[model samples]
Structure formats: C-alpha cells, structure tokens
Target: MNARPGSFGRFVADADAAGNLVVQPRMGFCAPHHMRTGLALTKAAAATTAGTLTIDSYTRVGDLAAARTALGEGAPLNGYPIAAHPAACTRALLDGVVDDTFPVQVRHGSSHPEPIIRALSAAGLDATEGGPVSYCLPYGRTPLDVSVDNWSRGCELLASLMPDGRIAHVESFGGCMLGQMCPPALLVALSLLEGLYFTQHGIRSVSLSYAQQTDTAQDEEAVRALRRLAAEFLPPDVDWHVVLYTYMGVYPASEAGARELLSASARLAVRAEAQRLIVKTAAEAHRIPTIEENVRALQTAARAASTARPAAIAPGGSKGTGDEYTQARTLIEATLELSPDTGRALRAAFARGHLDVPYCLHPDNAGRSRSFIDSTGRLRWSATGAMPVPPAPTSAGRTSVSARELLDAVHYVARRYDAAPAD
Candidate 1:
C-alpha cells in the first residue's frame, strides 16, 4: 500500500501531467458480481477512467442493522453496503479488477464516516470523499459541531492508514453543496475551507471539487479561483488536484439536452485544466443508468474532451483572477483568522453567519443568503447575508427573488439545453 503507481492521487497527477483528462462515473451496485463487473467496465472504458464504490443509503445513515437485514433477505439495495458485507467479499470484488492503472475510491454521503473508513481499510482500499459540513448540512439534521468532531476523528483514522503503505486521499464535497444556484464564490470558498480542514486533520493528499454552474465562463472562473485559492492557502507539502463535477442540478428531460450538458462539462474540465471529471449519464433525469449506459457516457465525455484545448494557463497550474477569486479569497482568509484549528474555525464561521449556503436548510446554516441566475446566465447573490464579501455588480440592486423566479433559475440550464437541437 506504500505510495505506488496505483495510488488514487498519484494516478490522477500522472494522468494530468500526460494531458489526459480523467473521467469517472458515480456507479455502484448491490451484488458483488455486479459491482465487480461495473468496476471492470469502467476501467475498460474508452476514457482515462477511475472506479467508484458508492455506498448504500442505509450504510451512509449508520443503519448497518437494516443493511444487514436487507442482505439476509436478498433484497436489492441501491449501492454496495461496504460496512455490512464481509471484508473478504469486498477484497474478492477488487482483487484483479484494480491495478496500477486503475484506482478505486469509495463515495459515501455521510457525516459520520469513521466506521465506513474502517470498513474500506480492512478491504485494502484507502481513498474516499466527503466533508464535515458538505456531508452534514445537505443530507440530514446532524449538528455541525458534532459532524466536525466526527470528521476530525475519521480523517485521523484514514491518515493513520498511510503507515501501512497506503496513500490516503480525501476529496472535499464542499464545492457541490446544495447542487445548484448557490453562486460560485461561496462554493469555491467552502471547497477550499474543507480542503484546509482535511489537511489540518492529517490528510496529505487532497482534491478540491467544483460543480459546473449556469454559465461556462463563470464556471471556468470558479475552477480557476479554486486552484488559485488552493495555492495560496494549502500547505505546500500537501498533494492536491482540482476535480469538476458535471452540472449537479436538474438534468434535461430530453436525451439530446442531457448529452449537450454532459459534453459542455467535459469541455469545461479541459478549459479549466481540471485533473478529473465526475460524469452524469443521459439517464440521470430518469433512473439509475445501466452499466452499458455509464460506459457510453464515459466514452462520450472522453470524445468531447479530446477535441478541447487547455486554456492559456500553464499545465498543472492556473493564474487567472476574477471577481470570484477576490470574493472566495476574502471569505477563506477571514475564516482562517478565526482559529488555528480548521474544524473549530468552520463551526465558528457558520455560527456567525460568515459562511452561509444560499438554499441550504441545515440547522447549522444561517439560511439568510440567497442567489439568482441573472439574464447573462451567471449565478449572483441576491442577498449577501452577513458574509464578508460584497454582492457583485449585477446583484447590487437586488435584495429578494420571488418563488417563481427561484424555480426558473433552478430550471434555467435544463430549459435552455432542452430547447436546442442535439445535433
């Protein structure tokens, strides 16, 4: 397990250095054979790819007894219950499928992931993604302070695995908070904050994520902003990369529209120099895609990416500055000054309304901030709340968004894409 060619972070770094944009799927299955087949198909895809083992909801919510009961009853669960299944069984699933060229990461949305980490470790896996705030606020009523303590201990546990020769990599889910229309600057700030929190808790390898937003130019600026903030704030010794998720909000009902949106995301990843992309299938608006559908989506994204040219930024680096950069940096520095401990600082930031999510209803969130999609398709804050950053020029005169406007903003991308012809 000692840092090898197969380490998740190292593999991505090497691929980025070689100018290959890595694409991955949010795929998992209940049956061992099915999960193994899914991973094998992902690795064999026509893209520079990675594998994911998404955990079931029961396990994510710490309902292991229910997970076990479903297993015993032969009822199909939504994803692999790593905590409920035997370690040996997981090992068998990954035995020959994972290699130096292919690395697998467990994706579970959990505020309390210590047990999941322990389970993954026993099966000889190390990389996983989630955050104290990101996983807590969006999914349930878990208190922010409690989630912070849980993640602090969980990160330490994952870091301890490094001594066994495995490279422990953690990706912060902070950037994808509330799925859509939250404004890019706040998303960027949260992602960087969570990345800093992971480093404080002992994770040396990390990745910051940003989801594609309403406008391509705005999305590009947000990704570059994230990279710049990482350079300014992360420990120099920490290994890190940028990952872009396909638009996480409403998907277009038209297959053609969905394909266009997915393609647009791949192009954005290339322009922003993101090392990896988490793709969504055309089936996203309907149901869980079949393995064959996932493979097709991976290949489609790969083709779109190959036709793209990297932005003027240097390979593996970015130096662009925009409004997003200024705002995100201001928020991050303000939060860091609150306390030496990142976990405590995050809790304080939220408690004081310094870090507020636009539509998030978590008990910890201030819930005072609001965002809207402007006529130009850029996400702007309609209310800055108590945050340190000022509202952008487009939002200067706006103090409120009507319920009808909010619904339209959420469906903005979908309607636009669906209206255009696929060809």
Candidate 2:
C-alpha cells in the first residue's frame, strides 16, 4: 500500500503529461465491501482511470445518525456513508487498491463539507472535489456565506494532509453546475474562479471541471477558455488541470443513443485536451448503474480516447475561446473586483447580479438568467439577466421562456443525440 504515484495531484499530472485521458466513475454503494469492489474493478479495468466514493443522501445532508442506522440495519442506502463509518474502516476499504496511480476522490454533494472532509482526509484519502458556490446554490438552501466559511475551513484541513509530503488535490465542481442548460461561459468562469478560491485557501494542486454541453464545438471552446483563464488567473505555483464530465443533462434513454453520447463525450475530452473525464454509463437514463455497466463505460471511453488525436491545448486566449471567453471573463473580473478573498467575493458577487446561473431556481440565486439550446444545437443564454456578460447573438435571445419552452430545452440534448445513429 505504498503511495505509488504518492499523491493524487501528481498522479493525475503524470497522466496529463503522458496524454492519457484519466477516466473515473461516479460509482458508490452503501456497503463498504461494495465500495471496495467497485474501486477494485475500476483499477483493474483496461483503462487509465481513477476511483470515486460518492456519499449517500443521509451523509450528504449531515444526517450521520440515519446513515449509521442504515448501515447497522443493512439497509441499502444510495451511496457510501463515509462520514458515519469509522476512519479505520474506510482505510481498510481502500487497502491494496488506492495507490499513487489509482487515486480515489470522495464525491459528496454537501455545501457544508467540513465534517465530511475531516472524515475522508483522516481515512488517508487525499483528493476530493466540490466548491462553496457550486455545492451550495444547486443542492439546497444553504446560505452562501455559511458555505464559504465552512469550505475555507475544509480546504485548510485538506491542505493540512500535505504535512506528510503528499499533495491533496481538490477539484472544482463549479463547472458542472445544475448539470445542464447552464451556459458554458458561466461554467468556465465558475470553474476557474473556484480553482482560484482553492488556491487562496492553500490547496495548490487543483482541477477545474466542465461538463459536456449541448454542442461539441461549444464544449471545446469552453474547455479551452477554462485552461486559458486558469493560466491567467490561477496562482503561478499551483498545479492545475481540466476535468470534463459527460453531459449531465437529461441523458438519451435508448442504450444505443446513450453509448453514442458517451463515446462522443470521450472524444470531446481528448479533443479538448482535458486530462481527466468523468464518464456516464449506458444505464444512466434509467436506475442506478451497476458496477458492470460502469466498467463497460470506462472501457468504451478508453477505446474512444485511445483513437483520439487530442487537439492542441496551448493558452490561445480569444482564439481558443471566442464569445465564451468574453462572457466568462466578464463574470470573473466583476466578482474579483468585489473582494480579494475568493469566498467573500463569491458571496458579494451572487448577492448582486454580477454572477448568475441560468435555470437555477435557488433562492439565493438571482433567478434572472435563463439559457436554452439554440437553432445550431448550442446552449445559449436566452436572458443574461444582470450578469456582466453581454447578451448572446443567437436566436434564443432576451425573450422569456414559458413552461413548455423550458421542458423542451431540457430535453433538447436527448432528442438531438437520439435522432442520429450511433457511431
């Protein structure tokens, strides 16, 4: 159980430098043995991959008592209850599996993630991903300020693990906000901005995430924008890379369509020059995906990525990003002007309309922004609200969206993908 790659940060960086697409699964189970089984399967898969331990609903919401009870009763919770389980138990679960090369990140959807981080870090895990704003605004009614404070403390704790000379990588969940229909500009801005926030809090080895959007070209533009912005905004000493998530919107229901979409996502990751890709299974549109389904998806992604000629990923600024860069920069610059501290700036930015998420109905969210898939199959802002970004020149412009329009926009990707034959 020696730290082979030694640190998740270094391990992923190695993969990036080697041009290997580091694929990871969102797999988790209520039982510790099941979680271990998933991780083992992922590590043995014939793909460059990482492992994930997603938390159950109770643990995510701070109901460790319920999680503990479920575990005791042998009831099947939705995901692993890492917080309620003892640290030794978690370490055992990861035994012989999680090394430098096979790093596992704890995925918990908690706005106040201090306790969870404490548990995961104590369990000898060095990587986890989430953001104060990204974790809060989308999931619940948690106050923005409270989440910021809690995350600052959590970052400090996770950073403390580096005293043993291993880097604890923290990835930003900001780019994957609301899963779908959020404009890539906002997603890119939030991802980079959150990475900056992590840097300020002393976690230097970080990753910024961008989920696949409606259009392939647009998604490529967004990832390039994120990389360009990272070079410009992130601290020089910090080690960072881009992670792409498969489209988090309403997935294609048909198995053929789902595989096509997943394959496209894998190709997109390579073409965008992302170091890591969070994959989606063919079972995504239905119930929870089994471990076999996850393994198949991982292998499929590896095959797609192996054949890909990754696009050139230099920091080309405007040439790399276009309008996505301009709008995202507007949002980031506006927020930074509010305060030097990343957390405080985020709070102030959202309080005003300086930063907004489209189609996000969270109370703290300004609710003014809305986006829709346009005529060219690109996700475009229908209304920018009070955001600093200019109005999009697309057909889905400043008009209001009715309930029917919103429903159609939500299903836009599913229809688009299903209409075409699987490659």
Model 2, residue 322: C-alpha shift (Å): 0.8
lDDT value, residue 241 of candidate 1: 90
Q: What is the C-alpha lDDT of each candidate?
A: 0.91, 0.87
lDDT of 1 by residue, 55-157 (tens): 9999999999999999999999999999999999999999999887998999999998998999999898889999999999988999999999999999999
C-alpha TM-score for every candidate: 0.97, 0.96
**Which runs of model 2 end up more than 4 angstroms from their true locations?**
1-5, 312-319, 394-398
In the range 23-130, model 2's lDDT, one tens digit per residue, is 999988988888999999999999999999999899888888999998899888999899889999999999999886798999988987877888998898888999
Candidate 1 regions with alpha-carbon error over 4 angstroms: 1-6, 313-318, 393-396
Clashes of each: 3, 1
- In model 1, the Cα lDDT at residue 164 comes to 59
lDDT of prediction 1: 0.91
Candidate 1 matches the true fold with a TM-score of 0.97
Name the weakest run of 10 consecutive residues (lDDT summed) in model 2.
1-10
